[model samples]
Target: MSDVASQAGRVIDAGAIRAGTSNAPGKTAWRIAWGVALVVFVMLWLFGKPVAGWAFDVPRAWRIPVQRWISDAMKWLVDDASFGLFSFTDLTRFLATLVEVPYRLVLGLLSTGIMDGRGSSAQEILPPLSWLAVIGVVALMGYFAGGRRLAFIVGGCFVFLAVFGQWDSAMVTLASILIAVPIGVVGGLLLGLAAFRWRAVDIALRPLLDLMQTVPVFAYLVPILFLFGFGPTSAIVATIVYALPPMTRISLLALKGVPDEVHELGRMTGCSRRQMTWRILVPSAMPGLMIGVNQVIMLSLNMVIIASMIGAGGLGFDVLAALRRLDIGAGFEAGLAIVALAIALDRLSQAFAARRPEHVAAGAGEKNLLARHPYTVAGLALIVAGGLAGLVAAPLQSYPEALQISTGTLGSDLVSWININFFDQLEAVKNALLLNVLIPVKRFLTSLPWVGVTGLLALAGLRLGGWRLALLVSVLSCLIAFTGQWEKAMITVYLCGISVVIASLVGIPIGVLAAGRERLWKFVELVVDTLQTLPSFVYLMPAVMLFRVGDFTAMIAVVAYAVAPAIRYTAYGLRRVDPQLVEAGVVAGATPWQLLTKIRLKLALPEILLGVNQTVMLALSMLVITALVGTRDLGQEVYIALTKADTGRGLVAGLSVAFIAIIADRLISAGANRIRARLGLPEGEGGHR
Candidate 1:
């Protein structure tokens, strides 16, 4: 009581509260166990045949007849004449028809023909001028949007694409993105506002939106392809689904963050709710909304390659084509072009968001000069100059044949050579992994009766979260079983599990090492940025080359991509640990390992848990993507649905994957929240609000 009580009574000393380098009694044993577990996981994962087989073999087949019966019933209802007025099919068809007219008009212009009903001119409708004219105009727009710096960057990116002989494809991708982004922004804004204003709508939408956010992109593509058919129409629909979440979240946040006094003032000015929302709320939320737009554009761009699968012709299609034929260089170039586009859009949107609204007097010189905004004037001049120069300068409009850079047949040859050279080595590992790890795991999961699996999950919930989370997990899991895709869903969960475990194994240590020095953190950040920016498809070529096609290749690709976030979060968590803790460890004659394990890591658990959560989400997202290498899971189901235009199957399968994600999300989040509460971290007040 004398010394301890005195210390406690004095000013609540921060240093005393700080952690130090005192190892827990079983720390060594725990570390050794972790090390052994990791080795066994990797070895059994990479080399053993039965282990892989267990991961994939199905002990129980889902009775999909119920789903098939439902599909048949739905099909019959749509075709039955007596149900016309109330038929959801009829309503969907009507909506499709409404959108078709504009879609056709745009498509017709891009095509080599005109719609006869419009009675347009027979002459080939040029885009008002040569390619040079378009470039000049866009460069001007870029300059106006930012400055000469942005103009140069934007113009340069476009010119590079053109000179690389990918001019047409680049424009196609750009056009779709330009259209999709606005639609996403508008749709997200409306939905978000509705959710914010109406408690009932909020309650109803929260789960649906959660479903949408977690659902695999490939799953939704089937419905979109069926409803809209292939081409830009399908692309736009999928893009909207993909990009809408961020906008919804950001808009809600901005609206909720608006000052109470400001909102009251608007009401006092006799503004109605609509006016308050449109004029006051939206304006106040501009910066946040612009950020949402930025996210929308980025996400839309990310989807472009996938959208290509359904014939939304663009750089995405080219990448896919190159991949199909194993043309690495062409794929790499196209991937780089995508990266360039992303960077340009991100910078431009950030500028827009950061720009402040001006407050000016009527007589101000700045106000007068606004008409001649420097960037605008400069842009206009460039447009004129470029167009005029193009009229005489042939090179601006067309690439010289002699100078055309070509990856040529070498790309294909490289792929073929690698496949031929390493097939034996690859096959052995693949066979072993498939038989040992993938198949056996799949069998074990499928072997569990639905009731048994649900019971275990509930027990886990009780341990890690609480009764509420246990109940939520149990209900969601049962939903998947009832949907008749339980086995496939389990496979997806297994793959995600494998990928996350591997990623954490690799990512956490790197993060720990990186966190030890400021310079290392900076370097790790740069690497993470590059990985994030590069298209996932780009990595596929290398993965196939090194590991060949199968679960291993898929694992490698996803692990590489998913590891970035883990490293980032770990470094961040470790760096954020109290400095006094480290000093205390040093003063107490503790070793580095003791300091990290007993002091820093214990304190950093909350943040690291969040990182693990993100890692799981990212890994699950790769499930469909990795299916390109061939795997039997919900992702494979979505892939099949896309090819067959099976909307019912795709949507259901996608929903199953989403349910799995939601269960994981709820469990991890509840656990994290509980831990944070105990550790005195700030609590999240659910959703954006």
Candidate 2:
């Protein structure tokens, strides 16, 4: 812990110290700040509660009136806004029809085997493949993309969803996702290309991306609800909004990653700019673009629950219903389906992204068209088989009744048994942890004056990057404070703060162990993969059961949701340390602990810092979700605003979360930069963009 703190302190200002002499202003400011921190620490140790709640908090009078004004303004806009022949609502309905064109068409094909559902009549012009055929097709694609192992995984996923009585819901969810992903990809791609072609466009898009990524999803739900109204249209729209940024940003990154030499080569060939971008740049960036696609899919999956809240029906709706009814077992079953679906989609997309041309050629010569296009051939064969089978057997026309299963009952019973048998012990553990750790921390942070809180942030920024960052942080801190949301924002910060602390402590040691052993590393990789892909809502189910609801529950959810990166980065950093250094340590007769602490960890500290930065961002992103657990924080504020459909309140609260995340991101990034600089590593690319 002491080592972690020292490393963090050094990282933030390592460059600052080097950038100036001992007597420089930056050095002087850092010294003064250190002295102040020490004094405050002593004061807290002595005075405790008296020192905790010193109040320079933003006043309520300043906040509530502005909220009312903004709310009234939004209401007026909604009421007064009109077009030549239609109102905003009418326009939304027209757009909704546009969105639903492909959605309903996909639905008809998947559910009823209709090809052209776009017109008045549905025609079974296409082969209506049954569940067996769909599973076979997916398995065949997986086999082609990865291998037999992937085939089994893909086939098993379809079987699991069908057998668990989610075949219809699964299809619905998949169709919606298919509809949203393409729109998000295309929209994001165009935006990214625009940004790539123009520096001004990139600069304009940067902060918007940050805002979209950082804002709690719930915060935007209300306005979106009003605009798009309810059902799949709104849900798909919401998903597109949330998922677009990463794709766009990655597009920019992929384009930027294309080497300058490649650009020069294109120029030497006399390729026009448009030709170069379309033929050379886009194709060259396929690998990165695929990665961006992977992220879009993940983001789309994450939005399933949020989408469900607004009337998009599918597995997510079932989970949300269960959660509302406090049916942990039911929620768990549906949530598990989500997890399975996510893994399947993630694996297939990842396999495709990572697939090399040689991997296909490895099967047979390129002249063997069957080998080159195995998946396509297999898919066509399945469609033929499925159509024939469906004609022969009615049961084959849809998911077979004999194969379906329902685990909802079993889950409920299991949860009931556990609650009866282990309730006391669970309660005891929760109580002890809350009393000893989480409560005190929350109290102290919520009680702290806004001035002091901002001051500390400014101090850290100042130490890291002198006056520029200090001013930026000061302004960010004031943004929340000036909004009259200081206390709630601080509470949100405290929750994230403590959750990150717990995550780091738990994750770092495990990472060290994993890094030292390959078997452990592989096992940890599986765990990390599962955890990262697990929908953020799944953690809430267990948290609710354990802590019931409130700050403690919210804290636990945040910790679970955010811990993967800490472990991943620690192991990654340690493994990346120069192998020669470890060999030298071995020759010096250094113990395993000595080798780790003195060599690997020391060298890997920068990456570990980056992991912490990610943890904070992830934790902050959970604020609105955590609010559902009933915590009195910015998340709760957003949640309340969401339920009431108060756009102004939700927007303000959302901004508060974004600003906090931005501040933390800025400071940690600056520190990581300092660490990289001191280590004489070349600066990383794709940072500003």
C-alpha RMSD (angstroms) for model 1: 6.9
- Tens-place lDDT per residue, model 1, 1-689, is 34433332221333434332364445465467556655654455455446444332323354345456646755665566355357666665676665455555554433222444444545543322335655666666666667788778877776677667676677677767777788889989998899879889878877887887889899878767765667677777788889998888788877888889889999899999899999999898888899899999999988988998877887899899878866788888888778777777787788778877778567666564536476566655755665466567766545465665666666657767877898888778777877898779777665555655676677668656768878889988877877678788877887888888889999889999999888888888889877777777777777887676877788778888788878877888888875765676656666777777766776566677778888888787778887888878888888888788776787788888888888887777777676555445576422111
Model 2 stretches with alpha carbons more than 4 Å out: 1-29, 36-55, 60-73, 82-87, 112-129, 356-378, 408-410, 683-689
**Cα-based TM-score, every candidate:** 0.82, 0.87
lDDT per residue (tens digit) for residues 246-298 in model 2: 99999998999999988998999999988999988988898999898998998
CA deviation > 4 Å runs, candidate 1: 1-66, 69-122, 128-156, 363-381, 399-440, 584-589, 684-689
* TM-score of model 2 (CA atoms): 0.87
lDDT of 2 at 77: 61
Q: Highest TM-score: which candidate?
A: 2
| TM-score quality measure for candidate 1 | 0.82
